[model samples]
Target: MTDEASAFVPGHVTGFFSVERTDDPTTTGSRGGGLALTDGVRVTVRPAEETTVVLDDVGVEIGAVDRVLDALGAQATVIGETDLPIGAGFGVSGAMALGTALAGNAVFDRRLLRDELVTIAHGAEVQAGTGLGDVVAQAAGGITLRLEPGGPMENRLDAIPARSRVEYVTFGELDTATVISGDTDRLTLAGEEALSTVVAEPTVSEFMYAARKFAREANLLTAEVRDVITDVSAANGEASMAMLGETVFALGDGLSSAGYEPQVCQVDPAGATLVDDRDVDGEITGRSADGSE
Candidate 1:
């Protein structure tokens, strides 16, 4: 189940890359399902100029690609390029896996369901060492309580109520892998107790508390990181750091006051989508180095 690349920036909970499995059910507002979804920020990292790589777009074709093909016996073109900025704590590998699964599902006549696609996509991410909890958030969208990792799309996905939303603010750039690898404990925090309570707690209240706690941590929220959060928060936007310490995200009611301020609005409850549909005004085609278009 290859996936489209995505970013898993920091500012949330941390534990390195520990995967836990449990029998709890993740749902929201009486709506429920047996599926596990991930959350994170995702961006397309295109090169400043046209470029090419020498692999099978590893991000797009993880171990599950063969499984997907075997299940449907589908033959589709798997195209991937380093269009995403790596080492910046983005879930580039996760995005590739998810994107591949999404694309493969389309090409394979929809042999696998959406939940199945998510499972395959996540499997690929676990294999890669470049993710935090963003995969679960991005897969689930909105605000979520990622209880445990692995298998069958079983997670607690809660929609951000009308009064709740997120704001993503990035300041400067840092290598996500390096940040995590350097201190090992600098980015770690205790979200388990909080997450456990959040699962059955009121969505608004839980998020409000989490948002407050997230703002107070020092190791997770370094000085430089805090400054960005403070600037945005002072502007009436709630803020946090993205995984890898490179970017910061702020949550708020609305970003109208943040106009042209070089920050992205961070409230996506429906998850992320990649469309084959192109912008006629901005069509892009990736080619190999051999002058092949």
Candidate 2:
């Protein structure tokens, strides 16, 4: 029997954070206190004789799937595909880990609860040093405020209502591990302030403003990225540099008019989902989350 499933996760922009590690074995990775974005990652998994992972857009090491397989004590070929640029602060790794865990459980009939599946994915990413909060934000979807960080169940999340279109452009990748492991005293301090300001207002514009401030104060902005931000701001558009990446995400046509081919996306209201595929005759039947054709 061959089974397949897919999940869609939105990209997130973390404004600020205070990292905390817990001794709880049930949780994995340090707690990430940040914000979730609408433009993010999408992953699909299928059963195979041997475990294998393939990424469509960017080239990076694939270990999250292996971690999931180890935890489940099962073997299957997993394929993860995403349009978002990997290692570009789009939370590709976190989304892939979460998608693999959820889809693998379904394929194997593991009967794990939703929260359990999320934890498995979270643990994999955390242990791998790929991400800290992307899984939590992806699971919640939309504009999310991660008040407390840990695994899914161990974290506290609240959504900030936003229906605005998001535009983004990627120039290059940044190593998440290198940045996360570095001295983040300034980053953490700026992030704490940004989080407080946004939580008090909780609007899309305010979020973008806070993110921009965090990027600057954290000393994460590159020269090229700064130029993009300046151009976007000059055009009177709200834009912010994505954390740990050489990318800039703007809210409107400000960047586009400045000769940037921005990829436009919307806030994903639904998180990851399972897709049921059945082979009928010579055709395959696929079902969406709502059981629609």
Candidate 3:
């Protein structure tokens, strides 16, 4: 095993989702559609006397990350960096947990498969209540459409099969657990409708249209978010709110055309991957996190 290892996990934004909760965390997940952005988390791992997690230069105790270490039976200093706003529907927690799983597995010589690492991280997020669908979507990458819920073992995933530049602007944060904890009757119904609509013609425009409809029917949009969407539509752009966050995302140059300077990135087709590894000898030329060429 190397003294240090690094992994990169793309950030995921769920446009709309339907939740399914069971007693088992492994089986609990969400059915949704979202984009995996190139703007994501980069995690570095090194052997430490004790386990710790730091993000963006600040020490933090992320529950899902801790749980991943426990599941892997490994301890290390995990450092993560990302520009995506936390609690703003960018799936930062899931990215951290999943990144740790990948980097930790490598650093500790866990010898576990990448799918196993993904399940470990996905389960940790479900147990911590920090996320539902983010881990799986981030793991799969691209414009993701989660057809079935649960971890990699029990879930079915599809994508929009197209690519484009993604644009996003965030207004503020939303409490994900609070919103998802109560009465998903409305959310589930709206999400199912949106999922079906997108499934019929899995296109970027269709995804945006369904997500906008879900945001309206689910009644989760803040005034600022709604206004931005209205402005973007008025400018003849397809835009939608990121589910569970007061963030708006548009495809292509939608936000730019609408006079909003949004953070721009391309869709990440290659999900999570090992960036590099290090030992006393120098860099260890590594393969993908999944152990593929």
Task: Write down the TM-score of every candidate.
Answer: 0.58, 0.87, 0.94
Question: RMSD of candidate 2 to the true fold?
Answer: 4.1
lDDT of 2 by residue, 192-222 (tens): 7877788899988888888888888888889
> Which lDDT value does model 2 have at 212?
85
Cand. 3 Cα-lDDT: 0.88
> Model 1 over residues 1-293: C-alpha lDDT tens digits?
33322222211222123224223212111111111122232233221122222123443434433443334345444444443334444454555555556655654346677777766665544434344345455456545455544533654444444323343444455655344335442223434434444456646445545544543542455676666656655776644555454555444432335442433333344554544434434433221212222
State residue 218's C-alpha deviation in candidate 2, in Å: 0.7
**Ten contiguous residues with the weakest lDDT in model 1:** 27-36
TM-score of 1: 0.58
Local distance difference test scores for all models: 0.42, 0.70, 0.88
RMSD of each: 9.7, 4.1, 4.0
| Angstrom error at residue 155, model 2 | 0.9
